[model samples]
Structures are given as C-alpha cells and as structure tokens.
Target: MKHIFKFLGIATLACLTWSCADIDKDEVGDESKLPNAVYIEGADVNPVTKLTVDAAGGKSSFTARAANKLGSNVTLKFAINEKALEKYNELNGTHYKLLPAKYYSLSAENLTISANNISNGSIDVNVKPLDNELDASTKYAIPVSIASAEGGSLLNSSVTKIFAIDRVLYTSSLRQNGFYLKTTFNPPYTNLQEWTLSYAIKLDQNKDNQAVLSPDFYSRVTADGGLQMKVGETDDPKAFAKTKLQPGKWYYIAWVYNRQHVKCYINGTLDTEFDVPKVETFTKLNMSWGAFVGYVREIRLYDKALSAFQVMDNLYIETPENPNLLFYAPLDKNTGIKDVSKNHHAIKVYTAGSDDATEYNQSLITWQDEKFPE
Candidate 1:
C-alpha cells in the first residue's frame, strides 16, 4: 500500500525546532519546507517489501534518509515495532505469524545522518529464523520502524518497514529416475545456430552414453562413458565433449555450441572443447532413463552461447531475467516441475508408470535434504 508519510513525534522537540506539519490533504507536496523530515530511503518507496531469504540466515540492509537536507546532524533511532505486524496481516488478508524477536536482530538501530557530508546510513537486519524452534511451513513478518529521530520528526504513516519473508530451503538435488523433463521448444530456440545449456548434477554411476541431455543420445561415443549433447539429426555427423566425470560428486555443467566449436564446462571451468562440422540439433535436455542414475538442479537453456565468466556467474543464481533465456528451473522439489523462466511452463513430470504429462503427482517426486553447494 502506498502512503504519504505524516510525521508527528517528539512534540516538544518538534515545537522547539520545526513543528511537524504534513503535506496538504490535496497533496501539495513540498519537501523544501520541512528540512528536518526523516524517512527510510528504501521504505519510502514501498513500506512493505517481500523477500525469500535463505533458511541458512543472512543480513538484509536498508538506508535511512531524510526527505530534505538536514540542518544539523540527526540521530535516527530504529525499533522493532512488533505491533505493526498486526495491522499488516489484517490489511493484506494474510495470517502471517509474527517473527520471533530471537530469530532476528537490528544491529544498526541507531544511525547518524551527518549534516556536512553523508545524509544516509545503512540499517542492517540479520535474520536466522530456522536457527530456532519454528514452523518451516508458516510465513513470517518483521516490521522495523524509524521510532524517533533525535533531530528529526517521525512519520506515523510510513514509520515501519515491513518485511514479508518466506524462509525457503531448496533441495540439494532431484534424482532423475525413470522420469524425464520435456518442453515444446519455440521455433526460434530449437533452430538457433548458437546456444548454451547449463545445469548442476551429481552422478551415481556411468554407462555407455547414459541419458544426460536427451533420450536419443545420438550415435556419438566418448570412449567408455560420459554425458552427451545432441548436435544433429539422427545418425548424422556429431560432436562430443568427452570430459571424464567422477561419480558421487556435484558438478555445474555447461554445454555451449558456438558455431563450429562445442565446449563443455565442469564446475564453471572448461573441461573440453572440440571443433566440429557445422551442425544443428533439436532441444533435448535433462533426459533420464530408468537405468541411468543422477540428480539435477537449475537447468537453464539460453539462445546465445555464454562466455566462461557468464557460466561461472550463472552457477550462483536462479531465475535470472535474461532475454536469451528460453527456459530455467531451480528444480526445487517443492515447486515440482515449475519453470521459473522468461517463458515459464508447468512442464509435466513423467513417471515410470504414468504416460500422461498433464497428470501431476507430487508423491512421485522425492526431495533430498541437502541443497546446492553455494
């Protein structure tokens, strides 16, 4: 909800310095008149912000700023306004539980807004909800307020910055059993001359041409065993990455097809690249048969070939807003086949005895306790 900040606090101080006066009811907003008015910079834009914080615990920051130049140094005091959460849940039509005080910390409750130089300072909020006793399934909220500015006024309207947080712990990997994930490719993507496909995996064992990228592993061989990427029509001249993958370890694999060069990346480093005859192939990714065993996460498909730096950077992120991205999935077992991509698709999860893609069955998928390594 958008609200114009109306500050009226420390009436004695306000009367002595500059009496708190709100903007006109018709909204003739003039910040020059109230030079000492204070408001949180990030919260000023949107008082309530939603965040999906890692259950491992981390810090969230916000900047305390003034509506205008501070005549003198202003000491802004922040407080954990627990009462605000009540009104927040009432308005949003949500039954979010109040985040326990022990789960979070306002490390920077007092910030100094220097009149000479810096007009703002950071407010660090450290949260570790899962560290204590709590329901992982329930949603929580933390409301932090600019309680009182020693040299500035406090706004009753935009006092608190509410954080609607959902603590999510992703599954380490989803074992690709008998099922395979498939999506109908658009004309532009399948026909692209250059493309990049990346994902994380852990191999259980290896067989000759074990299904990795596609069900139809093509007529290519990298000696005894390894993963494969399709590059041409059935039985046509093919390209192979030929990287030696060890079993029982996690790997961030990237298959980049840049014109005549086919590159394969392992754990963000170039494992192998070979010059191949000009060839094109259809989209076949994350294909797993009953015989082949492994796990996968963050499977992404891009239209253009990605650089080494881009591949390395891609390892740490999920569902990035890239125009070249055709499809992406963090493979969070909780989400269950939901693609968090530019063109997101609720791809069907094919099980052993289930032929229908439309029929969704959560019990068929198993979620591992471990999560992606950094």
Candidate 2:
C-alpha cells in the first residue's frame, strides 16, 4: 500500500454546483437491513490517492456515498481543508504544499445519497496546472472532507481524503537489455563543438556504484551510494555530490556542453554550471553496460547547445520533429530499439570482449515495457 493512514478534519462548506433542495429523495430501503452511514467513496478500501496533472491539465472526481443504502436521503456537503493536508504531512513526515484554488475547483460540493442511489453525485476536482503553471519540483495535494451532513452520520472516522498531486511529463519508460544497446553515428561522433542530451528517469533502487545512464562514452554513476551524480571521466567527480535522485521519484535531466562550459538542468531548472577542460567529443561514442536500475523513455541528442529555455520546452514534446535532433529514443515501443529522429541510427549491441568467433556467452540485454509515466 502506498499509503496506510489518513487524517480526519472538518472544513467550511465549499461552493456548491447544485442546491440540495432540488435533489429528490427517490429510493426506498428497509431501515433494519440497510447500513446507516455516510462516507467518502473508496474510504473502506484504502487506495493510493495520487493525481498527476499535465500541462494540458486534468479532471478527477470522487463522490460521497451511504454504506449500503440508507432508509432515507442523506445530503452531504464537502470542501477542501488545507489543515488536513498539513496534518497528513506531519504524520507522514512529508512536505506537500496545498494546491492553490485558482488551479483547481471542486464540483462535488453537495451530493445527496438517496434511497434510489447508494452513491450520489461526485465532487469533481478539475485542475488546470498550465493555466497558471505549477512548480514541477515541489509536491502539492488537496485534502477533501465532508464538511457537513444532513439526516445522516459520518462513518468510522472517514471524514477527510487527501489527494497528492504530480506534474510528471514522462508517462512511459522501460528497463531492457537494450539498455546496453548502441549505434554508431552516421557522420560519426567527432568534432562536436556544441551538444545537448536530455534524459528522464525514475530511480528504481538505492544501491550505489551503479551506472544509471550511459548516453555515450560519458555516463553517471549512483555515486555516494546512489545519491550523487558523478561527472567527468567515468564516475569520478566527487565535487559534484548532491542529495538528488531519490528512488521512486521522476526527474528530467539535461546536459548542455558548449565550448568548455557545461550546464546541468534537473526538471527544467538549471542545477549545475561549471567550466570544464574540453569535454569528451566522442569519436568512438559507444558503450557496454552494467546493472542500471531506472526507467527511461525520453533520451535525446542534439548537435546544437540548447539553452535552459529549450531544455525546459523539450520536456513537453513526446516526439519532437526537429532537424537538429541527432538521436531520439522514446523507448516506449515494443521489440528492438528504435531511433525516431531523422538519422534513425541503427542500434547494435556490441561484445566488449575479444571479438573472436563469438565464444564467450552472456545473456543479451533488452528493455521491457513499463506503465505510462505517472
């Protein structure tokens, strides 16, 4: 279970979509046989309450229901309670901020659970993250509760339901042996003055000393025991240590190299900037992989140095149709690695050992399909 406990709170009634006077109590039930209780939908069966709103925004709804069917109609009023979320954060030791009212509005304000319907109308939470735009890095949530009830009673402490919000752009990724897969550039990997590479990943394990992303001859390790990103030469930049890359969280990282300057952006924001002594313009840009534990569906390589704005904009496009893109791999499709760019580089898995008559045998690597990125 992603969550085990929930908080209970009382909030002021929110704006209602319809009046309770208009809703008729239609159904008939035997008072002795029916369970006389009112609660939020799905309160009995604990569910991970997470809602991810894309730039296009999203819509989700939950209703108030009567356990079984009450003998008469029970009208319930719901509202958003920020304190409940604060209490939840205190209990869970998390720092999730309250979603602003402008980005979201409730539609399930007044629901009447009548004899005809066990579960009545819903409170629709519509979120327009892109309208004003939400900070992609911080966690946000909404705590909803039945503010008031008429002719009914609340059930078993099921008052408030908290919904965590996410703004993940990468909805698809995979782990495959093709992880070690590579393809030689048509023009080859030399004399590159400016370049840009972007990757979206969700760390799967906390084990350190493992290389999670190897775009070419350059790769980053789970250095400092899976908390830091190793830069320069293979996993040696101790100075670049930072407590980033937490497991089970998604991150969109991009590296831009121009002349001797290097910049790293995490989740569309610039995180690292430094000057290096002529970075690797790999002529023989290839690799043999080890154990890499993460999900990656968005991998891009461009010949030109992309600014922070460009890197931020790139996160929204699934398959960008651009002339400068040298290699683009969505990695969400099935069977065989595919480059969706104009180059359409032929991916080939190479043998790292002595290339004799193929004697040493090692199981091949391939990527497996995963859930659409959350």
> Local distance difference test, per candidate?
0.63, 0.61
Residues 1-374 of candidate 2: C-alpha lDDT, one tens digit per residue? 11111111111111133433432331122234334567777855642266767767877777777665677777888888787778766664455678888888887578787765678667778888554365443567878888888888787467778776756543335553323555567556666788887777766665655554554435554544333334445443542424367777777777788885777787888877766556545533333353556666677788888866457645634334566788877765442357878877776544434332232222444455443344
Compute the lDDT of residue 232 as modeled in candidate 2: 47
Candidate 1: residue pairs that collide: 172-370, 172-371
Provide the lowest-lDDT 10-residue window in model 1.
Answer: 215-224
Tens-digit lDDT track for model 1 on 6-89?
A: 333333354545533533532234444533566666664677665556756766777777666676788888887777777765
- Measured with C-alpha atoms, the lDDT of residue 356 in candidate 2 is 25
Error of 1 at 13 (Å): 69
The best candidate by TM-score is 1
Give the TM-score comparing model 1 with the true structure, all chains together: 0.50
Q: Model 2 shows how many backbone clashes?
A: 14
Provide the RMSD of all predictions against the true structure, rounded to 1 decimal. 13.2, 16.7
Which stretches in model 2 have alpha-carbon errors above 4 Å? Answer: 1-171, 177-179, 215-217, 225-243, 284-288, 316-318, 334-336, 350-373
